[model samples]
Target: MAASLCYMNPTMIVTTSHRSSAELWRQAEEWAQRIGARAVRRQGSLAHLCELHEADGVLTITNDRLVYREPASGLEYFFHPGMAKVRIHNIEVGRGDPMIGAMQLRPGDGLLDCTVGRASDAVVAAYVAGPQGHILGLEKVPVIAQLTIHGLATYEDSSRKVTQLLRRIEVVQADYNDYLPACADDSFDTVYFDPVFHEPVEKSEPMKPLRELADKATVTAGALQQALRVARRSVVIKQRYGTPLWDQLGITQVLSSRSSRIEYGIAEP
Candidate 1:
């Protein structure tokens, strides 16, 4: 269970949106009851806002979806239309792009996303692979996994394709370093990793909160070797251009873009 895997904020309050329909508040209270979180009226001086410094965060249920507001971080996290990575994938798809050509995924390919942060890549993979394919995402941090799941479930988009893609992914809370090694040989058509970059860069507001909750586990040589063994075709690693993680893993074949700072390293099995 997620509770056993990682302890979430015990003081996290489930509250309604400041301005929302009455149904939204009812849903929020029911959700709060289900999650064992305190649900209070949206009036002033609620315990959640009162204990601002003492509380870890506030999980606010708006008419659309769940939003996590962290006062200490001064950041709000929720799923919306303007995710940068997903926009990049959409643009590339329009161009018939092959940023990670070696993946060679078809409609029936099975993919394992080692680090499914924001699940942008997983969404793209599922879109290309279609309903017949399998897409499994492993997230070490249970809180982030739960947040992503909620976003996927609650957010309604005008694009039916996007909504379907989001629904296709299966997310699990597990350390990939342990899970990857246990998988049988040739278990998946592609195994991919996009670990947080080792270098420090200016982050956007959304990334700031994510960085706080991300798994700090480094991708080791042994784990890379295991990924290669488990993958039937190729293993891809996404990282910032010229990241030392590539050198550490000795990844030679790379696909890059002069237009952007991100790059993908490919390892064929």
Candidate 2:
């Protein structure tokens, strides 16, 4: 079967800024058209939008970028590579980053990020991969993908390298399950998966939104097999340190941060 576009609730209307220029409104309208959401003027409150459509959330477009706000939950989620603190810290530290160690990346290695999440890893991977390398990110959820894409596009950072790396990653809305099998053998230097772990680590507020929104598919042996077929060097899976994925996938080599709760399972050909 072909990959399906993940669903976004139609009740969530796209609202624009009150002082938005004509050009800005046009762009916002285009965004609404693409996402299949109605474009409306911002009224008294965002809560009004929720009541107007009886929606769970509202997607707002300002001069800066696109943002999704769920009033009831008070959860706001958007992606900006510059804002990925942990990944940035890892990059700053240079050598002991577990993800960098797991991928074993060279200067020009191409990577496939099967579960992009906030594209944090993908951004770091792209930085490691260099300008010559390419990265493709697959996100199964439409709303998440769009939000991420918008953030990637609009976020401005002082560091030109980080900005360039963010632009280099191509985020597509498609399930990796459907996309992987179609790839030719050794299509990318590394195929990376970061499925929702069976165990939860210490809770962080930023991660809560991801846990709620991300695809909760269990990674199986079959999934690893497909990833292995696509990876020229190795297939890596990131999860909680003690998850069953290590045993299930026969991943004996686990590289982890001494201080962090996460680990990476490497399956090489």
Q: Name model 1 segments beyond 4 Å from true.
A: 1-13, 17-53, 81-94, 98-102, 200-206
Name the best candidate (by TM-score).
2
Please provide, for model 2 over 81-178, each residue's C-alpha lDDT reduced to its tens digit, 9 standing for 90 to 100. Answer: 63455576666777446787889987799999999987888888887788899999998867778877766776666777777778888888778888
Model 1 scores a TM of 0.78
What RMSD value applies to candidate 1? 4.4
The local distance difference test score of each candidate is: 0.72, 0.78
* Pairs of colliding residues, candidate 1: none
Off by over 4 Å in 2: 1-11, 82-94
Candidate 2, residue 228: how far the Cα is off, in Å:
1.0
TM-score of each: 0.78, 0.87
Number of colliding residue pairs in model 1: 0
Clash count of each predicted structure: 0, 0
